[model samples]
Target: MGAISVKSKHLLGLKGMDRQDIADILDRAAYWERQPKVSDALRGKFVANTFFENSTRTRFSFEMAEKRLGAEVLNFSAAESSVQKGESIYDTMRTLESIGIDAAVIRLKPTGVLEELAGKLNVALVNAGDGNNEHPTQALLDLYTMRKHFGEIKGLTVSIIGDIKHSRVARSNLWGLTAMGANVAFCAPDTMQAPELEHYAPFVTMDEALQADIVMMLRVQLERHDKGLIRSAEDYREQYGLTAERAARMKPHAIIMHPAPVNRGVEIDDELVECGRSKIFTQMEHGVPIRMAVIERVLTS
Candidate 1:
């Protein structure tokens, strides 16, 4: 809807967004896909990219999106910054603000940190990913990817597998997909499922999950191992990993997806990474323009 053009100054999460608002973003992203890839959409603007957590795709896709839009980018490295010396997140945001950064795309390990900072900041804020909270743009690009393939998101069945408890992608996708009329489900073990997601049914077995238009496998998130969420990679693969046998059982038209930094053998078989139905790489490619739409929308709003 016009809410994005009217009121959305920050993309903190997808929980509070309307269906039409979600549709608007996908529409805008589709529009951007056909236009020139490079533009001065954010010319003379300075955007800061701050990542407190390690990342490869999300961080770089954001950088590429900002550069493609012709915005001056300030890459904030937590390793070399005052944060390593105990500088608080608020202070770091203030530092960027004082220096006239027009917007910030941030990835942090703490949930709700972006919303807390959004209240105090003047520049536009884009939540690249937050701790098991939400990754709105990732969700947007996902919807775009599906729409590009199926001609629409409505009525399509989407099954998200793996560690839903710690996946911001799952949270984001649920909100975005369901809002656009898709039937969303989760396929994960009891420990891997999010108790908060009661509206959608989670299948405990892969057979039930494969009865969908899209099958998305999530990374195991080894960092959560210290918390005892998983035992070992072998143990995980044995229980819930997408093996070649399982992939073979999926519906003939069912496509595969993974939010990357994939542990190939642990989550999905290595060969399926580039399989005909796998949109894992295409999802990554969609990130740029979807983010371009987001950056333009937020900054101009």
Candidate 2:
């Protein structure tokens, strides 16, 4: 196996990142936001997207970011491949690497796959999602969006609600939020509570977290359905979801955010999605530029 080595590569996660790395990348992303239309920073470079799991928004977002930066992108969707018949991700990545692909973004069902793949490959690895482990890019973009609204992340109190335990987004946000000096208070029912965050103080009500500067609601993972987790969707929604009454309780300036594919009437009131308070759209919009920064830094730097 020929190693397509860069000076170094970045994996998508927060555990290994120090404060400087986070700040520097965010500064680069801020520069991306200012460029307006597009740039040719990665011109003539080839990027591979190995999506073992299904994704439209994230895939297209990465594609758009790559194309905008003037990089040629190879999208490998699993449906058309032998992955459906059970192909290993390492082999798939090796196959892509056999060609002239320079970098990779992977979405898989297993935690630590990107880190494992990164060690074996020469190219930079972006963890699109690894099971419910962590979605660092989403959290980065979310923070980037938050910085725009809140001036900076320092001291911003962010309340994330919904399927905390099963959400890669939640795990990532918790890390990013704390790293940025933003205190995070995520709320969810015991069923949806994120157990890994045992050290952090958690609230059971959206109202409790809404008391902060931002309320980041995460989407529940329906794909990992377990009957023991819920008696009924409506019942869960009634008890733990963000509702109109809850929305009204937020600081008028408190920015509302969701990673999206939001279950309406579940994690947020529908009105909050449209109101002036919502930063969800901003978070989505920032994904492309933030990813562009990530690809450029991990590949070129």
Candidate 3:
């Protein structure tokens, strides 16, 4: 594995990042994966995990990563914080820094919130997820999982299906995977697809896209569906869900993936979540070391 060299002090997004940087982080993650769980690298440091929106996987994954690195973790809750009384993201971040927090992993409902805070915060800021913008670590762990499976991420066909219009995962994976030379494609219904991404000739049919080496199914984003983007849940499943029929059609070597909090029987078949070819759980398992790499990179550099 290559030596990890990350120049940026904060992990804002994957867009326009050097391919070497991505590889470096993934390499560090691989190293961490083989090491014992507990680490004392950041023993004297303190980090905050602030989530303005609800999350289970990303939140816990980051907490675990921080604790493993021997950093004191401050779990910030939006509902219990001054933010509930109208404190802004900037003030909250600044307050955390004032209290001796070295870095923060933040997730917000607004797209540009993280970027706006990046310039102002004295401490390193990691973007956990910003609205429909991007989730950089998720993409990195995804790359690690792919590399573990195929021995390389380059030259693999990765099809991202469903809710491309509102999926930060799609955006992150699109940029990261393509930067690593993976053939990226998007598949979504007209209402769920981004018009700007039409240049890739996104497959409207699951059959065509499923032929790829990796088939990533995305959640329907029910929160966004309140605006009537989807005609019917049942219809959406029939049209785009990875049913048993579609799952069977995937290449024998092709793997299935979904960033979790999966809408069972919606974006994918429930049975396939643990199917031999499905790397869904493995992806979650990769979250810890991948995030450990990210935390180490941002805090040290």
Candidate 4:
């Protein structure tokens, strides 16, 4: 647990941020990762969890971070709120604020719903995920994980594979990988790939992407899409999925990563996940500290 020694507004992205902002946050997070010192930096702060979708990882990680920082957390979902009863989402945002919350960490089913709620709330707005658009904090954690592993980020080749169009992780990773000066690459089937994000990445094929310093995989959200997005999980497993053979093609020291709840054989082979080069488990550990950093920076400085 750590305290928020200073107060500040929320940080939604790297946009408009000078290089200093990125360095300080990363430095402080790296410091906290080592010390784990508990402080009342956020004493008396109140944060509300208004997730409109299912998320055990993000919600619980934030709750843990807030609590460790001495903030009170209020948790609930749209199904249990007025939004499910046909009330507007902004109205729901107002209702959450009505409870005198200090910050609102939201994850909604619709894309850009966070931006919609941002205008209406006086409290800080933390976007956990907004449809397939963005998950800023997730991106931050991923960067933190990368930084921890290599100690520097610039010019590092990182490939993220699998269902890009539907993955908030993919979108978030794109922003993060580019912001930190890492060379990013995306690979997937035509139907599942995100629109050419070459502006943010170097643009390489799966074979070429495998020559990365880092290799990450985004989960295939099978339940969310229509039939056309994927022909078959087995077919997908054959082509885009990271198999043991593909792992052999990767850089000798390259680390594999994923944002968990892996489909085992769908997006990545189970063997690679347990391999020595894999950083997937380490990424999960990075979530708590990176989230704590995000909570501290966004809610209190």
Over 1-301, each residue of candidate 4 has an lDDT whose tens digit, in order, gives: 3443433476555444444566566676776677554657688988888888889888988888787777888997887787778998888878878889988888888876677566656889888888877787777777887888898888888888877777778877776667677888888777776565656655467898788898888888766346678767777778788899988988888998888878898889888888898888887777777777777777754
Q: What is the C-alpha lDDT profile of model 2 across 55-170, one tens digit per residue?
A: 89999999998998889999998888977788887888888888889898889888877777888888778888899888889988998888888788998888877777788888
Best by TM-score: 3
Best by lDDT: 3
Model 4 alpha-carbon drift over 4 Å, by segment: 1-8, 15-18, 224-226
- Taking all chains together, the TM-score of candidate 1 against the true structure is 0.95
Better of 3 and 4 by TM-score: 3
- Superior by lDDT: candidate 1 or candidate 2: 1
Q: What is residue 87's positional error in candidate 4, in angstroms?
A: 1.6
lDDT-better candidate, 1 vs 3? 3
- Looking at model 4, the pairs that clash are 1-38, 3-41, 4-41, 4-42, 6-301
TM for every model, in the order presented, reads 0.95, 0.93, 0.96, 0.92
TM-score, model 4 to reference: 0.92
Q: All models: lDDT?
A: 0.87, 0.80, 0.89, 0.77
Better of 2 and 4 by TM-score: 2
Q: Judged by lDDT against the true structure, how good is candidate 2?
A: 0.80
lDDT for each residue of candidate 1 in 59-97, tens digit (9 for 90 to 100): 889998889889999899898899999999899999999
lDDT digits (tens) for residues 1-301 of candidate 3 = 3336778899999999978989989889989999898989889999999999988779999999999999999999898899999988888888888989999999999999898898888899898999999999999989999999999998999999999988899999988998899998888887887987677535556778989999999978766567788877777889899999998888989999998878888888788889899999899999999999999998888
Q: In the order shown, what is each candidate's alpha-carbon RMSD? A: 2.0, 3.7, 1.6, 2.4
